[model samples]
Target chain A: MTQARTLYDRLWDDHLVVERPDEPALVYIDLHLVHEVTSPQAFEGLRRRGLLVRRPNRTVATIDHAIPTHDRSLPIADRVAAGQIEQLKRNCTDFGVPLHGPGSGRQGIVHVIGPELGLTQPGMTVVCGDSHTATHGAFGALAFGIGTSEVEMVLATQCLLQRRSKNQRVEVTGRLRDGVTAKDLILALIARIGVDGGAGTVLEYTGSAVRALDMEARMTVCNMSIEAGARAGMIAPDDTTFQYLHGRPFAPSGRAWDEALERWRTLVTDDGASFDRSVEIDGDAIEPMITFGTNPAQAIAIGGRVPSPTDVPAADREALTKALAYMGIEPARPILGHPVQTVFIGSCTNGRLSDLRAAASVLRGRKVHPGVRTLVVPGSEDVGRAAEAEGLADIFRTAGAEWRAPGCSMCIAMNGDEVRPGETAVSTSNRNFEGRQGRGSRTLLASPLTAAAAAVTGAVADPRTFA
Target chain B: MTPFIAFESVYARLLRSHIDTDQIIPARFLKTTSREGLGRHAFADWRYEEGGQLRPDFPLHHPSARGATVLLAGENFGCGSSREHAPWALLEMGFRAVIAPSFGDIFRQNALKNGLLPIAVDAGVHAALADAPPDATVGVDLGVIRLPDGQRAFYPIDPFWKACLAGGIDEIEYVLRQAEAIADFEQGAR
Candidate 1:
């Protein structure tokens, strides 16, 4: 008998190569993306095994994390870092995988390039050596991050042995209020669910609120799913998704497009399909939220205060206290109006053109507050070009924010752009864990508008006031 | 020869979801290339102060957590960033096994490579581990895990990976053992 199935189950079952009922099943991968940070060891593993990548056509490579965004010249200043990048290029060439290195117009963050080049599409199983691989789920694909050994495994076998996750439906209904963008919506979701809310599930974001978001915005939401402890996040494909794929470099055209769309249309969860868990939120109720403490879940509305430890669950009270103590925040204190030393408006989470345009709208005539350093790093070369064409870079520069080249900059501090010790930053990136931005550096996660406002005010201020 | 896998028994209680790589080993500790000494720095930010002294306020630093090895972490336990240092630090910290509802793809592979067995238990089992005391002891077989109270669960492991782990074999050793098979196949195909 045919059983009712959700989109996740359909995809899971289709990809399953070996099903050992009680054990993880080996699922096939449609695409494998590699980058500088995690590819080194996997290549090393391959070298140790004296094995070539079995399926070079299915693999792609890029350099972003450790490569200096400003300097593209060879022999990077940091010898060790330079070696890793060089090794990756060599490995990609050796393995016959396409490598988008510096100066390659296509070169950018793996997540950014994937969609722009139409490499990410619906119903495909995409694996990358980066956590934000979930960003591709914006296209209705089953994408997740893997490690070096898994990279090697995919190289050798083109499959991953994974246990299926229960499906979840996070329905954000109603139209978003004006000035509330995708970043705000995701921050609001994170706030409601806490960082670990969607654990053990694949969150299928649906409803009018999700459908209304553009492709870039959808990516922003899915990119932060890892922050919510979700295995991955996805949205049902629609006209918007198909339109974004049309005429792209790697996307199919003509008959293939028709075929792909037909398949994608069926990629949505069946109407009667049940979810392990479901949550509903009103899009109108969401305001620009910002994280107050270390975890993304430690967030509140832009005008809200740092929650008192007592207000939190007893089990989480200690963590709140520690985060507050480490952040130099007090219980019940207003965090929105708290001052910040810097503003970072970039990352795989919110580094697309739309994100920059949204931030640019807020910074048009305003200047970044004196003593607050602001930086805007685009997600990719294409995004950077698009922003520059729209004069978004001019607005940022005029506002005293440094517009940087494409790379994962202050996002993880893997590169040199890091928040100084003990200084607080309002960032549009994911993860506010201790030392995530830098050692002893404090991070407050917020929407791009909120970060822009913090740049202008030198403090975390409500963006709604400026709006 | 089989790989020299240094096996040790661990019994750590699980931390809730989203234990990111940054938290596994902070950025400051990432300056060095050598994987040695990472165990002491594992969870350094959450475990101790700048002076290397234990943070009295930290939960894992409490007396109750002493000698714990097997960690039962929440779902998506090593989510965010593919920093191999995370698994390196966890393994070096003397954690022989990590049981979670789900593990970040890269973190799981790195854990396995470093001889830190990542066991995926049911959501209920994970919640139980989180609710259990820090001193709760759990047994970690290759793909089967037994909780402190004797509840047992079996998780799937790739057969190829299972053989490697069972024989205490590293990736290189596994490849070497199959060299003859690979050569024979290549010759026949040609």
Candidate 2:
């Protein structure tokens, strides 16, 4: 009899093209998502080697990381960024790859566009140069990030040499409390397990709490898997997954959809399957969490006090001290009521339609604090248009927040959307690393609701209090 | 990629945990299409002050760290972001290998592909090396890393990657050698 296998095992086995014992196996890739930042060197490598893209149809391109979020009507002001974007357009056109460039209506963040366009499907192996490619695993795809060389490899050949990762189950039991969110749950998990806790593993998020999350929420959870040092994160395909992908642009239609559903329904962990490492978290206990330090794992519940260096283990003291110093926060201080100069509510992590709705729920009929500057950027043009149609854009604009176009603005600090030095920003982006937003800029990672609360109050405040 | 051979050099000790790619090479320096000359900007935030003056107290600029080709770092080195520029910059800065307790998954892959070895040692060995003098030397020969404590620990690496590093073989050409197999797999998949 065949041994019971987890969803990860099935996906890995199905994608294996050539097995190499004691080494990484050759695996076929069903989708290759490319962007301007990581694709230039890769395409240059292909050109240098006289290699053509093997499967242009299976490849998709977009411009996100370095594109300006404001005023696309004018020429790109940054010459280097404009050159890179122009290079991408030329490369895509030359190689016959489809590019959703600016004005394409589908232009947006790579991870956001993939699922919204229905390119990410269950049981498919998806890869992108960006680490948040784990975001695709929300649909049960064996998706992960690759380097530029690997990107070149995948471009020349629609396959990659990859090692099979061990299975790690992050099962959250019970329902999340009111005002808690997928962002809070993920931060809580990362805080419980350190930054490198899930190294060399693929995390399969399961249990009642995970199953109850909608597609966008699940994407938020999986998007930060890399922050926990996991190679990938996955959730088994279910009705929620199916419903999200049903009418997407690239989704199968008619008989194809029926066949796809039949196959997707089988993409779950078998009973008696065991994980290499497992951790259980009580979803009911997870409150709204906010990062007080540089790494995602340096998070604590909003009501908790900043941990003193002495309170931590000796091994952790140095990191704690460094983090506290960089964040300009003293140990033993309460995280709540901490002043924030800026509030940002968007990224691959929390820039979806529901994310916008959650933020607008808190911002409706409320003006942002005069002391704080707020920016609300959508994940894609599609998301931007939908938000406009729903009046979410109006709410953000009326609430004294700048409603910008879709792109990865301020998240990477590459597109001139950045917090000034020494300024504290309560952001909805994933990472809280030093200078992540800008040089000497202090970041406090939070959920969209919490970020909106901070914008309105100009300090770190509980979203439940807003409710 | 250049072939990596057995060698020893002065090790730089920047023993901070979770040194992410952004810290290695900030996003502002990433607008260039080419991967050349990123070493100047590696650890730009830490290496320089606001006015572009080198911080004398920075680890890389310290007297002991000058000319160092090996980095003795803390756990989870090269976390966050899949920019291969992190490895490219380190290699360009003359770092041949990094010894740490742990490494970020994507960073380790990128380092290996670029001929920069990432040696993940046990806590005991890492602490021993970390406690050593800043200018002390370390050796990496094939799969084994020689610590100053006289401990020769063998690090794990895929045989294929090991050979690739040793030979500086182009991975694309190697994979293309099996085009027939890939085509067959695609046929069966369809």
Candidate 3:
């Protein structure tokens, strides 16, 4: 019998075009996702080199990261952003690469659209210029981010030269309690392992808790895999994965579906497959976590105290002190009741229909606090339309939050949405780096329920209290 | 394309960990199509004040690091974002290499293609260089990096990337040179 191989090993073996020792491995790519910000330079490089796209059909492009979510019907006011979007359209049109530009019903965040359209499938090697391409790992794919130069490489050759990563399995056991979410689970893991814990490794999040999460929740978990500094992450494909893939726009149907499913069933790690490192987390113990600093790993439970420097290991104390100073929070103080000036409820991480529903459940009959500016930005036009059809948009608007179109707004702050200086925002977006939302603005990362609760209370409050 | 002939250069250090790409070259700085002149905006947030004026307190202006061509960074340098602008900014600013205990995977890959050498040493070496004085002349010759006290530490690099640097060729040039092999492989794959 062949040696037991983990899902990562299997994907690596199958995708390997050529592997010469001590040189980067030439690997075939199944999917190449592109967006405005990183693709311009890449396409420009190809043009400069007198190259044509080797596999245009394998690439999908979208306008995100800089597109205005508030007013897409009008001309983009920012000359720089307008120019970037125009360049992307020009490049796509010139090169025959299909683009989901603004006003295309399919236009949305690249990560969200890829899976929703069934472009992401089991056992494929998917890459994008954006780091959160790890979101596609929910389907058991070997997905990761590539730099712009690599983006051009993929465009010209439909393959990338990669150094294989080791396998790390993060197994979360037990059942999740109420008020806890996939966002909380990932945040807790990052906090437990530190930011660099997953470095140089592809994390396979296994165990009962991970398997229980639906495709959307699984995407949320995998979306932040990069936040922990992992090269990529994946889950074993199963019934839940199949259910999500079924009837998707790009998914196989009829006899092809049965055959695809059979192949997908074999995508799991074998029973005795080994990982370079293994970590265990108690899923039930994870609470709605929130970061009080400039990094995603600086997190604590909703009811927990802002940790004192003395409370942490000596090596981490200095960063803790610096974080506390930047956030204007006292060490040893309870994080609850800290005032929030803005609340954001979407991104590629938490912009799915289920994420909107989760936030809407809390906002159905509640109104945001008078002091807070709240935004419920969807991840895609499809997601936005689906939310509207489900009355989620009405619920958000009735509760005093701005119901904005889908794009990566407020998350990167490159778009029109911004958290003003000195204002604290409880956001559902990934990343909490300094000036991530805006220069001199502070950020607190939370799940949808927790963000909704913060919106209503105008402070960091327990979602369970509202529940 | 300039061949990387290892040489001693001016150096400076950022004594903090997890310096992300967003911190290196913020999103606003990414508006330009041309990669030229990003060197001036390298670490713009910290190098300049909030109001867009140069801050006097920043060590970038210190006499010792004024024209520093190498950077000593804390662990996990270039942590966030897959933007290659981070390396372009560093290279444009005349940084030949960055010495750190560890680096973000994407940033490291981007640096190699752009001729910015990412030199990873042991954490102990990083600690030793943590106090590297201003006006320091660090030494790098092939795999070895020498510190202020004349201590030399070697680093491991991908042989392919090494060859590219030595030949002063980017991936495109190398890939074009292999056109026949690529065509042969494409025919087989099809």
Candidate 4:
């Protein structure tokens, strides 16, 4: 008898090596990504144990968070940050793991570098130390974030003992209205399901709306699954996925590609496969979204009014009130056209070539308000090069925006690129918590196009108007 | 080595979910490699002014919440970044136990190593505790939590991690102490 299966079951069964009752199962990792921020301690742990990386070929390292994008030369100003970067290089060199250092052309955010290099393919298990590792799920992989200890485990064993997660399918149907992008769709999903909606589950995003999105857009949707407490988020491999993987550096070639496609064809959930829980939303109902408070879930449609504390459940009212007071936002007021002092467009979430092109389309022949400071940091060196070659950089510069090199610049502000205190920025990066950008900096999360529009208008303006 | 878990008392209600490491201790405060004195800056943005004076608006700095050791937080606590300073600052701030519905995987591991008890309670119970008065005293027994209103509930904890937290043993020390047992097990299997 043929076994009935879901995509999660198929992937889990394929990766499982050893299973013990009441104990975690050892599942193999197909790909491992490392970065400067989280790998130093893991490497130290390995050295202390006198173990070489069991499979260095399976791992790839990059420097992103702490590397300054503005100055790509040696001698980073921050001594501690420079040491962390130096330690990562030494560790990768000692272990035989490939390192994509600053200005390496391949160097960028670990999440962005993985997909662009074609190292992340469909139906593979990808693990990284960064939570945004879910970005690889755009290729229909089971990618999740691991801790430093788990990173060390993967380095030594090429496997992790993990408890399986339940399956969930979030079906988003109907065409997304113009001005709405993948970023908006994800924000709406979090708002509807709450932050912990998919806890202990692997979410499979399905339906026409998902299928219609490009790989970059799909990545933006899956990248925030961790924010929703999901183990990972994925979409079924389709023509778009195959096309995106066809010419990449590490992607399978010719006959090998054919064989890979044959396997990927079988990677979808079977008909009638039941999910532990499911949710359905009309994509048309979602508008451009902007976060008003700390949590990603504290968002509403761009043109929509801020929610009153009374509108929320009594149990959650106090938190809502606290968030409003901290953000200095008035409840029941429209967030549309709120004045912003700065705008940032880049991150693992939406710093791909397509994201840049989309923002450039809105920015062309327009100038940013003189009062506003707009920064466009590409996700990786490869993305930065591609955007510059495509004239997207010129368009951004023409529009009074600062076109910068690739690094996780202004995204969480660990690299010294930060929004000034109390300055509200329309940001494309994830997380808008107080001081998330800098101490006392206010962030309003939006799509790249919306951020571009905000930069030009010096306020939170609708991107659809430009479209 | 006997596990020397020293449980401190926290006297305030913790904030909600996604209390990320950045908020626990801002990036500016992370320039030092030494893990000492981070506790004083725990929740620095919310707890103090730019001038380093305590902010009266902060929940932890409130007069009613003084000297409270057991902190009750919302679900998916510590949800962003793998900064160990988060748990370090919490431990230094005298938070012995953090009771929440869930915890970020990295933060949970970091907390265990730092002798901070991360107690995972039911979501409904967490909600009830969040609704509890800011000054309400809740006892977080690693085994069970007793509410001020006489309501008591048992919470599930991973026994291995539980032993470590109770003994104040970290993974490195635990593995070192069990070296003989591990060696014996390997020999017996061979």
True C-alpha contacts between chains kept, each model in order: 0.40, 0.77, 0.54, 0.23
**Per-residue lDDT over B3-65 for candidate 2, one digit per residue giving the tens place of the 0 to 100 score:** 877998878899898999999999998988999989999999999999999998898888988
Q: In order, what lDDT does every prediction score?
A: 0.80, 0.93, 0.89, 0.82
- The true-versus-predicted C-alpha distance at residue A75 of model 1, in Å, is 5.0
Would candidate 2 be rated incorrect, acceptable, medium or high by CAPRI criteria? high
Tens-place lDDT per residue, model 3, A1-467, is 49999999999887777777777877788899988888888998998999999889989999889988886778889898888888989989999999988788999999999999999999898999999999999999999999999999999988888888999999999978988999999999999888889999999999889988999999999999999999998998999999999999999899999999999999999999999999999998889999998899999998999989998889888988988898888999999999999999999999999999999999989999999999999999999999999899999999999999889999998877889988999999998888888887799999999999999999999999888
- TM-score of every candidate's chain A: 0.97, 0.99, 0.99, 0.98
The alpha-carbon lDDT assigned to residue A399 of candidate 1 equals 91
Stretches of candidate 4 exceeding 4 Å from the true structure: A1-3, B1-11, B15-18, B28-40, B61-69, B109-115, B122-142, B146-152, B159-190
lDDT per residue for candidate 1 within A179-241, as digits (tens), equals 787877887888888676876788899989899999999999999887777778998788999
DockQ of each: 0.31, 0.83, 0.64, 0.27
Q: How would you encode candidate 1's per-residue C-alpha lDDT over B9-44 as one tens digit per residue?
A: 435554655577888887555544344577888887
Best-fitting candidate, scored by lDDT: 2
Every candidate's chain B TM-score: 0.81, 0.96, 0.91, 0.81
State how far residue A367 of model 4 sits from its true place (Å).
Answer: 0.3
A279-337: candidate 4 lDDT, tens digit per residue = 99899888989899878889998889999998988878888887888787899999877
Pairs of residues clashing in candidate 2: none
lDDT (Cα, tens digit) per residue for candidate 2, span A106-217:
9999999999999999999999999999999999998999999999999999999887889999999999998999999999999988899889999999999999999999
Lowest summed lDDT across 10 adjacent residues in model 3 chain A is found at A14-23
Computed on C-alpha atoms, the DockQ of candidate 2 is 0.83
Against the true structure, whose TM-score is highest?
Answer: 2
